[model samples]
Target chain A: MGFIDARELPDGHTVETDVCIVGAGAAGLALASALSSGTGGARVLLVESGGFEHDDHTQYLHQGQVVGREYPLGISRLRYFGGTTNHWGGNVRPLDAIDMEPRPWVPHSGWPITRAELDPYYERALAFLGLPDDAFELEAWTDGKACRPWELEAELAETEIFPAVAPELRQLGAVRRASIEESANVDVLLHANVLEFETDDPPRAVRAVRVATLQDERFRVQARLFVLATGGIENARLLLLSSSVASAGLGNDHDLVGRYFADHLVIPPVGDLWLSDPELPLDLYLERARANATGRAMGRAIFRLPDGVQREQRLQNCGVQLGPTMPLDVAIRRGKAFRSLDYAWRAVQEGDLPDDFHYHVANVIADVDELVAGGYRLASYRAAYPTWHVDLIAVAEPAPNPESRVRLGDERDPLGQRRIVLDWRLSPSDQDSVRRSTDLLAAAFALAGIGRVRVQMPEGGLDWFRPSPHMHHLGTTRMADDPKSGVVDRNCRVHGIENLWIAGSSVFPTYGHVNPTFTILALAFRLGDHLRGVLA
Target chain B: MTTPFAVRRRDVLRLLAALGGAGFGAGAGVGAGAQAEAASRETLVAARVRLRLVSPESASLLGAAYLRDRPDEDSPAHLAVALGLDAGATDIAAIAARHRDDLRSGRVHRLDGFGFSRTELRLCALLYLTDRA
Candidate 1:
């Protein structure tokens, strides 16, 4: 059995390991997988909040795939060994070099290390994640064939196609679980909800992780190194809740633990590209499209702001995807009876593994128009039939807005910790990023042989509207060399705090328009290497 | 979340963010007390309006702009107040009544989720009828 299939934890009555990692989801498991495999005798203690997929919460809370306000039932994020990765679509993109660059307008921007440094780790991440190879790039590589992301992006999309990961991710997760279980030093614990970090110094040390479960019995696992790889919201929640040393919580010197809360600003299509060039390889292109889109037509190509555009503009980082025309109303309806459809054909419009739950309707309409009219039916199945065609979704870049943050709540959780009141505040600059991105899209949509397009900013404008539930929350605990700038320093370590590292997108200084699991898992791979020394 | 006197920039941003997050449903901005005292009351039809974020060039859009129905009458909190929110009472229905103008004009913008309300708007049409009351 693979790493994820084994429901049983490491056989033990409280045994010791060289290192202890909290959170078993994507980041946590990825790190453990890398560490156990790479390091010798690295005693590892992996703590999971929930159990296997069959576990009560996994099936009840996450099986329905509730997120944002969209889910019909109350959606609580799953606490498990694989964490949220189990639910992820696995669209992996390395943190771009420009993403690490300092933008004066973007407050709390800049990663201490460069993208080049993380390149090798990203490769390790890709391999572990079962993602496609990074095309011909020397820095990043994976076993999967040409990833084949559409080519609006000069460097990335042409080479990278994120391997369709819904089923495979879980399957590989099994392998990862067994490899770790068989290891002599590694001890895996199920239902281990790490409640608090009892620290000695203000920002210098972590003595132990106070872990507990619903059963009420709790124990403190004292490890020289304690890593919190929970997730974007949970990581910050834990920090804010652990009000032991500082009321503001651990590593929240500037109250930055849960600030700069961000998500993908999911833009609907203004129009689809009626390609003037018939020479384009359309069928071959569609096959490689990540198993996300459900319908037929050309694949998604990443949008890079023209060099001149990037240089002159206040652009942080942005990308866009070209998808077949699909209406929200129709998709929601089709999704209601999603079970019976020929999902193989539908996967083209959506992604590989068909999920009606979280994914935006990528395949409701296949852009299959009778005539070569620039505009087809507006929304075919749904009633807005006046205008029809595939649409362009311009994903704006994410900037750190101190105003956009998660705050602590007075209410306690089942674990008796303060509930994190997520107060995601976007700065004026973030709104500008959207507008600038819209303008760039307009310019590109006009230039690229695509069809008519419109850029729709939120009604209350960018600041006043909700960023879509695209599941791309990032930049709460940013990493940097300077203490004042970010939460963790280079190598994903919390500045000044020893033996406490963070894995996952929480440490990202900026966010790109891609799912973070692949790259984040990559970072975990790199971090696990650094941690192997501590394990010994 | 709100202020006693004029809205502070921080409170204003927080209020706007909340409204933006909540899709400018009117009642979503009720948590802040200061917004409650300085209520910009309007009718429901008058409150639900279109809006966009304010940037360098677009900030001009913030000031008074008339809606589809009220072409002449301008929005009260004209300069976009974060997405579409007014810090008022927690009860959304009451809050919607108090700040009808905020909704009618683009002073606040609604967050996403099939925002163009047909039914609530029909009720708002009923509200426009009883204007004198």
Candidate 2:
């Protein structure tokens, strides 16, 4: 078997391989599987800090202080083999072409590699993700019934399709674990925590990696090349921790190691869409079974502004999804009644009334009939269709700000490694993008005579509506053509260092308004093909 | 002499009065408070006439029936008093006019003291527009 318990190995043992991958998460495992299956003659060593299941001791290592917003650090990520994909929702989308182009208004906002360069790899990544190899065409999936004639001009807004494969069948560990076990030239080592890189003089090239096990076992893995497939945060953390050679960091010669952190900002429901044509079949815009496909579900059709509109308005990429809404009174009463009963039951269990017990009871008494009617509507419509209106929930792309970064804190973990301090910052341009995009959409709907849209601003206005993080960590170690602007080059190799590279969303220069897993996998495949060519 | 709008208005007024009386009678004994019941019936009639020009069918489809069947505990008199109107007065037309003005000014007028929600306030605005027409 390719699996090896690193703790069982003899102390001071040295293993030799052609390539040593530091992490066994989604990117790491995908790259390892690709290399092992290739015709190349290179042997691979894949290291994982945690075992097959969740381990609290290893999970606790991810805990750290959050500065700007209240972020749940400990629960946001997993330390196991599959990484965060253990709980991912499996939403995949490719970055738009505009997302890869440099916008003059947005500082440090462009990719060294364009979307066209990644298109072939994205097609290959679909097989890895278990999605259909065909293009994400809405007509093919919906049997031509999905597209409805838009009354508005197509330049204003367009329908975007999102396809979701079964997450369980496509999880990295679940899909490739068997193949990895039977591979002849690949070694899977669990509980092997990569501590630092031991480099030759001048530290321009990586020679060996030092790994430590929880049981105090130490070993060295010498390889021809080393790839840091660790996640966005840890990739920078490992580089920063390996300061014995470069002082600032291995790739920090230009002082740009851990910078340009970004995450998608999901704005709260900003408007309500009351469709004039009540007979319009909205099932296509909702989660439903594909017409001919079995065991696969088609995601809701999202509305995105066309590229021309985005450029004209100078707004960031944002997409809107329709969410069911109801009269505020009905929703409040039903919610209050349900919460009251839940609190009463909890009070019976705890033997004490909650502080807001009377408030809940009074709300239930005030609108009992409306509450009953709301319940009937909810039961009949399944809470997916609103009785009167629907809300416009916008998922927006945040601008790349060099100030929003992840740095090492003074606190140390059980392994004596410094923890991360996340300062997640959003710019004023980010908020402006959301506001302007909603305005343009509302204007388009009005011009088309489809319906009226009422922008629902908070009592304190747009500033009061704080954008919540989408947990998509990206852009920390960005890719740029020059070493002065980024940590990695176009090939994902460390700018000045040889035999060292990066994988995953850490190399994303700009994050589009979609999930990053598919893109991460595609980039890993590209890197794998490149490494195969180099090693051969 | 009644047009279709006026006829529909009358029918809606009768329905609203009936619903209000039935609800009030259920909550409070019908025979014990005949004077208060008569006053609620008059208020419902006045409200129906004031809302005659609005699309009563659309208003009913939007769950106006809930307003009648489950009227808030506070009476129209209490709402008028809270709005700084004279006591014993329930001029829904005047209330609707003020609400329309607040909406035109892009301000959300507080209706919590009058025991009404935004949906209920919208219905009141429809009544006001009908009365003006």
Candidate 3:
């Protein structure tokens, strides 16, 4: 393996390789690792836009404005060798069988590939992520003790397991960096930003990829195959930016390069659960209780609607997790510091300070006593092992909406490339699904005499609903058998383009409430196999 | 042998007492001082006509609270009909059964953000009236 800095390359230099991967994120690395181990003679080029750590220049390139909804785009993702995996929360779970199937109620739902197609690669992905293949088995973790008091009648809800990777192995980039650097057939290039895809006259195939560095050094990488493993938004932006030959863009014949963007909607502490039996053993679902013998929090158990119930009710998948409720005093103390910090960061992003900024700072200063007390309590054992009540967090799946898209804005970055304009939109049915699923969960708990759930959602429609993102960008370059419906084919190859494929959550046709890292790696491994055969 | 009605009345009373003593009232402590005040005999007798098998004092307090909150369902006749109890029935066992069924079937009314089955609501209403009425 060779580690090269883009600046070290001479200007107008050309490098040739068998396979060129555009992003050295989880997908790129996984694909590279798979290719290096399986494909005997293929030379792999792994290119990254940033160095090993976060840089201000690359972060600025990620800055974009929102059109339809207010979303923090720049701060949500990282730009480095590891990509967003550098700060990923480490929770992992494969998508359910229903998530891959098309629902009659959901317009642009369903994947060209099924769960069975990815099953073999999923095990490899888990092993690559440093977990046992059986990590998602909820019964193994709880031994059935964590189930509801009575069997939920008619299978209204089901429990799903989400295991957190080991703390030391959480940063996949750092964990696999040494091995990737030592692979004999791979070349890792840092600060090698891809400018555009230089294609033939018809734009039926990608000829070469133009790469650049912040220092004005430009080069070209011609490969037999190309993969844009960039994050979801960047993948679409790159495709839409490559307009040198096709005029519209490479593989943008149907104008579907950046449509149907989706991300998970997370609502923290939606309600409180009051258990009828105070001594009920729900430890499997709590953070501290789930900690293994090594004192690392192992995983979490979540509640979601069963497949049959989802189809019958015409609902999207919504996951609800139960954790210990934060004491009100602790919330107030933590909230002051959080509010002040959040406002300051947003002000910096906007390049202007708000009038009430001083008030937030003053409030934080005034609550110093609370801040210290809250910190001490959080570090103490009592805070970790709370048993009084349970707080419910709802993470709802996003239905693909063509109107929710990422497009090029008039504004350009320092490199003269048009910045992204993300217009994220959610349908009314999305909100309705969340409400209905939450009610069903409450009903199950109530009927079992386990407890009661007081849903704290405001009384009204989408106007009163404000959902935060889980930072899992998905469905931007969705996979479908038909070119008109999606950008990528079942094999993740961009439709209507030869030798061009996508590898990441961006190719996900539907994103279940689960995290996308596991499936992203699975797809990467699957693509690696496909590419090996093609290059063979 | 003790009848099922005796066990049910005792249980409801115990639950009501526990809620009041622990201050876990679903807003049941609006007028705490009223419990110190006594209801007139005529008022007690009038309230007692609505239900049987429950103590006169318990019946009076609960009936007044029930009538005050759900003024539309003025008497036990309406409450029995709403709870799926036999019309005009004053059986405590039947009342308890209806309460359990409501909870089991997800039929609950909310008061002060706390969910309560209709039977539990009636009892909570009684607790609130005892402290205030």
In the range A1-536, model 1's lDDT, one tens digit per residue, is: 12322223232223244577887777887777777665765567787777766366433322222222342122335555566555655455665677777766566666777778888887776566554454324223222344322234242113233234445554334547667767665667776667788888564688877766556666667777888987787788778767778677888876678777676666555224323222323332232433223221112235555434554666666665555445553454344233223354465545666455223233323422222122223334424222233445556666677776666656665656666556544556655665555544543332222222334454345445444546665777877777687888888888767778999888888876566776687788888878876655
- Report the error of model 3 at residue A335, Å: 11
Over the true interface residues, superposed, what is the Cα RMSD of model 2?
14.2
Predictions in order: lDDT: 0.52, 0.69, 0.75
Model 3 DockQ reads: 0.13
Candidate closest to the true structure, highest DockQ: 3
Off by over 4 Å in 2: A143-152, A291-297, A325-374, A377-387, A458-462, B1-133
lDDT of 1 by residue, B71-111 (tens): 33223233222223334323344333333333222232221
Q: Compared with the real two-chain complex, what DockQ does model 2 have? A: 0.03
Q: How close to the true structure is residue A534 of candidate 2, measured as C-alpha lDDT? A: 83
Per-model chain A TM: 0.77, 0.87, 0.88
The lowest-lDDT stretch of 10 consecutive residues in candidate 3 chain A is A288-297
Model 1 segments more than 4 A misplaced: A1-15, A54-76, A134-163, A170-172, A201-203, A270-300, A306-308, A326-341, A344-388, A457-460, A463-466, B1-133
Candidate 2, residues A122-236, lDDT tens digits: the string is 9888777766654377665454443443455587777777777674554577667888888888888888888888887688999888888877799998999999988888888
Which pairs, if any, clash in model 3? none
In model 2, what are the clashing residue pairs, if there are any?
Answer: none
DockQ of each: 0.02, 0.03, 0.13
Error of 2 at A237 (Å): 0.6
